[model samples]
Target: MKLVVQVKLLPTPVQAAALAMTLRACNAAAEYTSRVAYERNVKSRNELQKLCYREIKERFGLSAQPAVRVVKKVVDAYTALHSGIRAGTLGGERSRRRVKAESKPIAFRASAAQPFDDRCLSWRHDASTVSIWTVAGRLKDIRFAGSADQLATLRAHRRGESDLLFRDGMWFLIATCEVPEPEVFEPTDWIGVDRGIVNLATTSDVDNFQGRRLRRHRRWHARKRAELQAKQTKSANRLLKKRARKEARHATCVNHRIANDIVAVAQRTGRGIALEELRGIRDRVRLHRHQRATQSSWPFHQLERHIAYKARRVGVPVLLVDARYTSQTCPRCKHTARSNRPTRDTFSCRRCGLAGPADVVAAVNIRDRARRAWALVNVPVSMAA
Candidate 1:
């Protein structure tokens, strides 16, 4: 598993400026490498490296590792472009023409890549300090701080490349750490989880995680953003950006808690989690303007992702069940119809006397679907219930 830990650097003014200069120099070399690759039609990292390696060193006065990093960066950009063109996301004809006509190098801002094998980057856990190469030679013993959990994880499992990111007058070191994968479980039963805008999640066992508070918070943010947008001032723009970050952080915290609770329930019950395959749900269903905005703002995807990773991390399997008619289908009588759902929160079947919370019914259906699907694929009856 890949986990990222972001640590705030507490660098002196001199160290900060040196770091900034290093990042700028890295970007300069990258920009130059990109231009050279495009002009020479360099298609691979090896080709770009061979063509521009020596020139980059001479032009940017960078050591070998930084030059290689920037050259690899440009190669990766071209690789992404090629993949986009192949996938038909970027118009092949237009992309080809643009590539041929491209003259200016791409600009980078407030970011630098640090490869792990390079000698320029080192960390000292005891002092909470880092040593990094800069344009002004090397800056050593730059203090950094983060949460206790993050610091522990860094000390324990930090691996591979990291990025130096500058934002809002602060420098941060973003490191990726490796985590041990959870054991694969052969679940005896499946737990259904229904996700919605109103309630974050409802389980087949009648447990619910309400989203009303989050909805209100989102609406409040929307209004605040609109108010600031109307002012059209520089300070308003800054506030808007700050509010966005705050909202994201709040949502992420809520998602983490909800996911942990859901996974805990599943783990306690020795059941796998079944969820709706909500891909293209917005486009599949039509909604009014306000409803559309609310639905768009709903963090269903984020919640799903959190649940998935958390489940996997705890040896709980997660399945994506077919979402069609899960809400409208009657769990009691197997009756399915649009009329069965009389309200957003209430589900009642016209053919039968079945009635309950719409989200709960959906969760039950999802759970059953996963059970049937898993039963069909697996040979062991012990694994399915």
Candidate 2:
């Protein structure tokens, strides 16, 4: 499995200035290359590199590798844009968002991250320092810090390019690491997880990860953001961006904790994990005008991703079961109807009178579905035929 380890860099003032200049120069070169590609209708990385390599080196004062990286960056941006269009993620052909996206060449932010290959960057793990190529010159002995496990992973499995990014007045390098996944063990049972807006997550085992505290936290931030917007000052605008990042970090921390707990239990009980397939959930469900913001802002996908990656690391298998009627179907009587869930949280079967929390019932259904699905998957081919 491929994972990224982020380490914070502590650069001297002189080194920082050089890094800032290098980032700006690279992005400026990328913008120029993008314009040329747009004008010439060229998207091939090699062909575009041939056209812009000299200009990037001479005009932007970049070295050989940095120049090549800039051209590749421009080509990648166009590739991603085209991919989004093809995937219909940007919208339909005639949609305003799609039209706007296609009307202009891609643009890079001034502080956008830049990729550095081995030729342009080298890590000294033992000394906790790095040597990197900058426009000013090669910077040596720039210190970096990370957690013990992160550093170990970097030393053992780090490979490919690292991205240099500046954010929130700090610098970070995100390095890719290819870790070997353990062989998956045969499961004794399964743990089903039901995701929701109010509860965040509920397992078939009746463990609840509530969203009440997070909801309050977001509401407070929203009120503060409204107050800051009303001020209409530069400082307020800056603070708003800072607050948004802070809120995102808090949500991510909460998700990490939940995923860790769930995966730990699954491993301890010799069970696999089952989750509902929720692709395009926003499109499948309708929302009221007042509920749109809350629904859209919740990080349902992130929680699922965390669970999957953590499960993968420990050799626990994960299954995505069908999501339809999980909440409405009665787990005991097998009766299926909207009336089974009279309220958001309560589930009651009219036929057999089975009652419980709606989220737990849904999770139980998911677990049952996984057990049947896994059986069919593992069946021998010549059993009957």
Candidate 3:
């Protein structure tokens, strides 16, 4: 498994300025290289490197590693562009009518990150600092800190390329790390989890993680954003962006907590988790104008991703099953109809007289579906015996 652990950097005034300059020069080099590649119709990385490698090195006054990184950044952009063209999304007869500009070159922002290889970056354990090669023609040591968990990963499992990121007047080093996957668990039983905007999650075991507080918070944020947007002032727009980041962070924290709780329940019961496959749900379902915003803001995908990862970390398997009629279908009598779900929260079966919370019924159905899926994939030991 690949994960990025962010470490906070504490750099002196001189070192910070040097780091900023390094990023500026590196991004400028990347932009120049990409523009040249696009104009010359350079497609492959080798072709791009052969064309602009020396030019960037001499023009930007950058060392070998940073110069190579700039070439790589531009090559990746061209690769992505080619991929989109092949996929019929860009620069083809199909897209020519839809998109007016086909020959536009890739552009990099001034604040784009500069990638670092192991040769250009090193960490000193004794001083809890990292030394990075900058545009100053020397390595600059910057103190860094992280949570104990993050520090442990850096000490044990850090791997691959790191990116130097500048955000909100702070510098951060994002290091990629590899973690060993947990052992696969044998199928003993399965638990269902229903996810919705009203109740963030509902389990077959009757546990509900309510989203009232979260909804209220999102509503408050929406109102504040609308007010700020209406003013159309520079400061208001800046505050709007800041609030967006803050809201996202807050929502992520809440999602982590909720996922932990759901995974804990599954682990305690010795059951694998079953969830409804909700991909493209937004495109499938239509809602009123006022309801669309609330529904769109639902972090269903984010919560599901968190739950799957947390479950995997603990050796608890998570399965996604078909969710077509899970909410309306009666789990008791197997009756299927739209009338069964008369209300958003209530499920009343017409044929079997079965009634319960709509989300819980869906959760039960999802659990059964997952059990059948597992049965097909693996024969139980008792049955084999």
Top model by TM-score, which number? Answer: 2
- Candidate 2 stretches greater than 4 Å from native: 231-237
lDDT of 3: 0.86
Give the per-residue lDDT of model 1 (tens digit) for 217-288: 988999999999999999999999999998988989998898989899889989999999999887799898
| TM-scores of all predicted structures | 0.88, 0.95, 0.91
Ranking by TM-score: 2, 3, 1
Which residue pairs show collisions in model 2? none
- The lDDT for every candidate, in the order shown, is 0.85, 0.95, 0.86
lDDT of 3 by residue, 23-120 (tens): 99999998889888879887777778888889888998987778888888888877776677677765566566325435577888787777898899
Top of the candidates by lDDT: 2
lDDT of 3 at 74: 83
Native RMSD of candidate 1 (Å): 3.5
Span of ten consecutive residues with least summed lDDT in model 1: 109-118
- Please report how far candidate 1 places residue 45 from its true position, in Å: 1.5
Task: Tell me the deviation in Å of residue 213 in model 2.
Answer: 0.8
